[model samples]
Target: MPVNWRLKLKGFGPFDTQLDWSMSAGSAKVAIYAGNGQGKSTISRLFRLVENPQIPFPSSLITTGSAKGKFSFTVGNGSADLGHVEVDSSTGVDNQLDYLFHVFNSDYVRDNLQSRSYSPSGDIEGYIVGKSNIDLSNERQSLEDVKRKGIDARSALSKELEESKQELVSLGASRVKEFQEINVDFLMNKTVKEDCYADKIEQLKAVDELPDDAQAPDKLHLDDSYLDLDQLASLLERPYSKANFAEAFLEKVRRDAEFIEAGMRIQDGDRCPFCGRRYDEESRLLISQYDSYLKDQEATVIAALKGKQAQLSRLIDDYGRLEAQMLRGSSSYGEMRRGFDDLAKVEFPVLATTADFTTVVNAVIDEIATKNEDITLCVSSEAVGRLRDALGTCQSQLRDANKLIDELAFNLGKSKSRKTTLRKDACAELGKRIRREHREAFEEIASLRSKYRLLEEELKNKEAQSKRSKKDAVARLMANLLKGVFGNRYTFSEADFSICFKGETLGKSADSVLSDGEKAALAFCFYVASTWELINEEEDKNKLFFVIDDPISSMDFNYVYSIMQVIKNLQDTFELSRTRVLLLTHNVAFFNMVMGTKTLNEAWMLDEGKVTEVKNELLAPYAAHLRAINQVANGAAPSHTTGNSIRQILETLMHFEDPSLGTLGDYLESDYGGRLNEVAYLHLICNDQSHGTRTFGYAQPPMDDSTIRRACNAVIEHIRDRYPGQLVTAGVEPSENNSSS
Candidate 1:
């Protein structure tokens, strides 16, 4: 059972800010002193809200520019762990403190007692029990089925949502990591990767035309044409035929190829260079052979063909080196594949292989040797055309290589753009993959959410139908409310839920005849009676708590004491090991009475958003009022109630001499008063400002606090000079050398 409570109130009524304005109550008799306009009623509403949170927010509590109007209430046996009752403008209300809170204020009276045409719905404390007598077991079973289905659907929907979220999360992370691994500077981090992808996607629209040449970045010469076969064909077309040439000599020359080559250089003129004989046949044969060798057209053609062969060999070597340079490493190849393969979606063309290129080169070399060996052999047009055909194959291969290099250059030229495009391509691939892989989970979550909503609606309809027979709480509540009362002063007729005043059923007539004090007292009895209902139902009475806010409003001295006695009787009747009462009032006499003997000495003051517990002081209300005025005389700040205190003090003194002298102007006209001319208008401003709900300070274009303080101070001093002895009766001790003369 919860035995104690504490509340934090702010941004409502007099609090006017989002501050943790706190108070500890209910373990003992907590008395808080707050004058009118100091948020007394707002604090009461905080407790009332706990008993019933469904009540519409009272618009009157909101200030013009205050914090998000919110309330938080808690209950415990003075421990760090506590249960909470929360309400805010946003969440409406969640009353977790249970029904431990009860309040008595003008609202309680107006809601319960004054509005005599009460029905079962208006019973805030219907604290109702006992269900319908009629049997609707089938309808209840149907509602139970919906409740179960709702629970299961909600659980399944939650699971599906979690799974879908995980799938997306895994996909996003995998894509982010893959883009980072592409080893590009722009895709260094996750945010950069995503932003680069999205930005380039937009940028890619501007560059809608594809890369200028779509081929591999590595350029390799793969055709025999790149071997410069045109020059080889031209060398093959040369003539080296001689009709008088000797066959045997030619055979010898062929056999002695090295000797003939040397003889040709030595035989510079006519003399037989080898044997030193002139015009001899043998020497001439040697000289003629040398001369024939030097002028041999076939030999000259062989020399040109050999030169072309060397040039082709060197060209082939350059092509091989270039092929090796472009397609060098696995890392570079993989990067290229990732960028172009995924984005272009076109199959990458394979370049002509090294073995194929080597085969073609060897064939062209053999053909060159054939032409060189038989220089006088007329080159066949068929042979030239075949060579040209092979060269054409080589030309096609070279075209492929150049196209690949051009394509590679085009993409690499915009590598920043390429990187962006690559990132975008990677992102897009993931989108398709995600849609393909997790489509079921996404669809299932959405389907379950709709099913859950429908089940909840079904449950509501079933519940309403199941409650076809409900027992009215009115008769039971009226019986309980009439248990404890102030004699036959007022009896509530249960039929119409109206108060029977002396055999006449008072409808709205309760307001016509009864004074505010009588109504307050009558409302308090009903409030007490509701607690009797609580005491009967509750096994542990200590769990119940009551907050009485200004219960003795406008009550005379006799009814004030009667109200106090009634509250004490309630405490005795509670029969708990301990009883807690938090009596908050702006009424001075009631505060003094509740605080008990002057030696009791424990009192709390709430002023200007702060609370102070002043112990070990005489708890006299009028004396405190006078002391506040005296403190202002000695340069202390005045309180909001300073004007009310001044008015009371003056009213008490002026009426002491003449009961009819209600105002300062009336007092001034009397014989014992000062001249009537000066300061008469102070009556209009000072007298009416401290009074009631339309307290002039709150109603009119308000005077600042200081302006009201000065006015109240002036009146206190003016009266204190003439009636110092009367001030003593209220409790300002006379000074030894006081200037009362």
Candidate 2:
């Protein structure tokens, strides 16, 4: 069990002065007596705050004149401080103090019974138990793994497909079908070697054919009939001289007289235009000789020879020009030029000016013509053969190159188509597999999630069932405690699953039917019973400390005795040596009763803003009220304070027995039969004399002390005659000689 060995309070609540409470080892119980609002409940609430650090600290806990407060305590046998609560600018406590103590006070009673009708749905203890045991880690982890694996597998497959598609694009497949259909055999096989055929095709295209006009002429025929053959022979046979040609021409013209005269006129006559001089016999004779010579056939032949020689020179010049203009690379033109050069190197017969020279020149011309004809025939025939051979070679090479290119293009087309087809097929297969795997993974995840959800539902159902069972058990215990406290005057039952008194549930009609004392008794019984159930179910009973505050409030003397017995039974049930119990109350009579039993390890009285240990002494407000009453009856001055004490004593008695007479005025007027001045009683006691807010002035003309003393005596005599068994004196037991009416 967790026990507070030492507790210190500084600037906290009504305890403005520092206070220390140290519990000795093996001490099981401590009883603290304090009047209303004297910090008895504050101590109980502080223990609760220590047990649950998450609860907000009470603002009222700060001392009246201080801004900050602190509470410190050491738990169990260890001297180390287990927790501390500080209230200053902010309020906080150590979280390590959770679940160490349990407290039952008026708040517990109100929450369980009086605040609302008690019902099974409102049973909080079972809910606490259910929430503590819920586990779903393994199922969630399995679902996550399934999802992760599926995602990873799909991602890997998609990456592979994307890479394969990129590879196909690099291979020059423009469309899907092109790369999809490609196979290894199609790639390896080549219709034509690219290095061998591609260049050959280009070379064949570069070889161009020559035009028809560029070819050599088919025939060589010379028109030498226009040539001066005799002159040509003469020039070839004789030494070439312009002067000898003129002398020969003159000798030929001397035979004709007319020609002679013409010649004489050319030599000596100035009178004639044709001849330069007059015609003499010698000149006539010379003319006659030239005339005869002119008539000769040899002269005419010489003229013809000269003409043939001029024609031959012109032909040679024309042939030289033709050769210069011929295309250089033409095979036909080349052959023709070579033939012409060979013909020019051959020699021909020389022509003479004699009559026979004509025939000789004619024969030379004929020979030259024949040789030219032969050269023409040979060049034309050879050129035809060479040109034909070249054309054939060019056409054959072009045809072969074109055939190789066509084969290569066909093979390339097939390769692309095959690759496209293969790519499409492979991608389709991969996509199908990926989809199938994704579906399978999705189905698996769905199945796992379904099972996980069902398990969650099962857990919720079991928790609800457990809560119902625990609530039923608590209800039975509460009903039994209620019966024990109320006796046979009331019967308990469950109506709408709520606690009912005498067949009526609380807050329905029980309030009107039962008195305030009965209601307080019911609340007390319920709190004690619930606490008993909780402590019995606790795993570590030693760690629990029970702090009960004012359990007997609004309860009659009969219930007070019963409640004390219940507390004693509880202490005995759970060995007090193991569990620590702190009971705080403002009821002096009850406090004295418990103190007289000698069952408590220690007892302390809270009065005049201080807590001090007390033994065998009555504590105020009970002691104070009793002493003041005795003093007044013994001739002491009856002041306003004494008047208030007289009223307080009467109020306490009326509340304890006849709770309907809740105030001193109500008891005085109703039970005393108007004999007591109720107005004077209120004026002397209940009026706010310190603040002076009455309709009259602050000095209300002090009532005659004798009159107040007489009133006090009348009330005391009424108590002694009506209920003499009740104790009214401090430090004195009730008289057994007095009897109830």
**Best TM-score among the predictions, by candidate number:** 1
Candidate 1 lDDT score at position 605: 62
Give the local distance difference test score of model 1: 0.57
Off by over 4 Å in 2: 1-4, 51-56, 78-89, 98-100, 110-112, 117-121, 125-469, 494-497, 504-507, 532-537, 571-577, 617-741
* Model 2 C-alpha lDDT per residue in residues 1-741, reported as the tens digit of each score: 334556677777778887777665446577888755568877776776665454465677678888777776655545555553433325577534433466777666665566564332334444323323344356546556656755565455446545645643553433655344332222222222222222222221211122223333222122334444343433334322222235555544323424443554455432434635566787676555554554544444344444454564564544343333322222232332221222223222111123332343344555443322222221112322332343344345434433433433343334434334434544444334333434444354445556656766765665554343445555666667766777767655643445565565654556566777777777666665555345422334455567888887777799888777777666554444454678888777888777677545568776545566775544556565665565565566665566566657666766776787655556666754344454455434434433335436656665577866776666555556665444334522344444341
At residue 588, candidate 2 shows an lDDT of 73
lDDT of 1 at 509: 66
lDDT of 1 by residue, 1-741 (tens): 334444566667767754354544444557777655567788787667666665567566666577457777665665654578776755677876544667898888777665663322234342322233134466556556656765565465445434533432433333454433332122112131122343334334323333444334455454344445666666666555643567786666656766667766776556656876666677666666656665666656665666667766775675576456545522243344344433333333343455555566666677777665666765533444554565566566556545645665566566555645544564544344433444454355445556656755764454454332112334344444444434566666656656676878766666776777777766776676566444323343666777899888767876777677666665565565555566677766677776673211236666556555645322556555666665554455656566666666566668787887656667766774553235454455445557544444555664555665565556566666676664655434555455463
lDDT of each: 0.57, 0.52
Show the colliding residue pairs in model 1: 223-394, 224-394
